[model samples]
Target chain A: MIPLSHFMIISAALFCIGLFAVLTKRNAIQILIGIEFMINAAILNFVAAGRFDRVAGGGQMFALFAIVLAAAGVAVALAIILNVYKHFRTINPDKIDTLKN
Target chain B: MSAEQLAFYFFASLTLISALLVVCMQNLVRSIFLFFVTIFSLAAMFVFALADFIAVTEVVVYVGGVLVLMLFAFMLSNKELLSGLQNIAGGFKFTHLAGLLICGGMLFLLVSAISAADVVNLSWIKNGQAISENDNTIHQIGIHTMTRYLLPFEVVSVFLMMALIGAAHLSRRERRS
Candidate 1:
């Protein structure tokens, strides 16, 4: 049987994986996926923390808000990526150097 | 281990594996698919953690709704820019090593801190203990939204509206003269 500490540890590992993905990936969409991973890790932590917090359920509620916000953010980012693709014909992110003075 | 602890391990493993795939997979579509799996597993974990409301939101908002739209956008922009092996470094071995070391250190520190702390069960952390068990879960959330979190909620709505307008403008091809 797993322990709460194990959940916390696994969440930490997931968070690290997401962080590594965000830091190492060159593609914008991949980075976005990393961001999604990070958010999910946080949400997992929150929900787990909320298990013992039945009264307020603040952590659980926050996870809900986070899920919505992540969706919104991902949508906006994809639109921007589409624009990036249209302009450069490439989405390598590192290659989008026109705006970078 | 206790039943709660056992369930925690079960779901935690699911969350970690899917999350790893979400980052490591090279194909964008596959990556997005893994992202959905990760979120669903997380929702399951939330349920196991006794966060029914959060679990529902994680599934509905994240898996059912958001991931679908994101994958649709990914398909729309599926030009396959890089050859998946262009000038990219061949797995920066040193960097990967360094990252692992640092992450390992961080993990050790976190576990130690948690263990060392004189912690007790935190059930008495808040007032109005019956709030979670009440039938008006959504209704109570709404009340809190207006009473305490109204400003942030309104801002998020505005942000969503702006994002919608911006996406529409950005995606529309201008009629060339």
Candidate 2:
């Protein structure tokens, strides 16, 4: 049987990678992609931990709710990004300086 | 190394590699496609972890719905940004280096924590038969969603409806402007 630590390690690595993307990427869509990666990493952890909680399946249930929430968030975020592009004419977060003083 | 172990390693590597590519690739469209690979491998990993229901939902919602929406948004937005050459056209800067350092430190901390932790294996295992017999996850999830998780489930549905309306409202072009 594979140790639970193995899954944890993979998820951790995935989360770091996602964080790196979120920090470095200038494009709003790229940042959103990074955020999606982070969410999936968390979902991986939930499912892996859920394997041990066989009776309640709380982990799986949480993962399900998380997935739904992520989808909804992505939809809303993309809409907002689209609106930003409409006004700023650029999707690069670094270039959109309208809010700056 | 058994079949399950082998499968786990394969999917895990696939997920990690594609995730790295998603971050490294500059082309927005290509990055989105690589994101597809990342999500697909993650779904496979979910199956290996015995969350078959979550795996299917991941594919349907993430790969099918969210991905398609992202692609559509990308296409509908600025035409100049469509090509790979023009997307993210810039040199490396200080932020990239900072991100590397931060992420490297975080990875180190997380690995140490995982190594230090003691994960108890539940006695629910009965010669592997118990694991195989516990395949009624879908039924269990359904029952739990209707009972213990009913409130959250209803809230999620309402939240989804709100998001749909919000997206539609936000994306509509203004007449006066």
Give the candidate number with the greatest DockQ.
Answer: 2
Give Cα distance to truth, residue A52, candidate 2, Å.
1.3
- Model 2 regions more than 4 Å off: B82-90, B120-134
Model 1: residues with Cα > 4 Å off, grouped in runs: A1-7, A52-55, B2-4, B82-95, B98-102, B116-143
DockQ, all candidates in order: 0.50, 0.62
**Model 2 pairs in collision:** none
Candidate 2 positional error at A99, Å: 2.8
Per-residue accuracy of model 1 over B64-147 as CA lDDT, tens digit each: 767777777666666554456344535666656776677677768766765665223333432324333335556656666676
Q: For candidate 2, lDDT tens digit of each residue in B35-79?
A: 888898999988877889999999999988899989988887757
What CA root-mean-square deviation does each model show from the true structure?
A: 3.6, 2.9
lDDT for each residue of candidate 2 in A1-101, tens digit (9 for 90 to 100): 56767888999999999999899987788889889988999999998877766667778999999999999999999999999988887797878877743
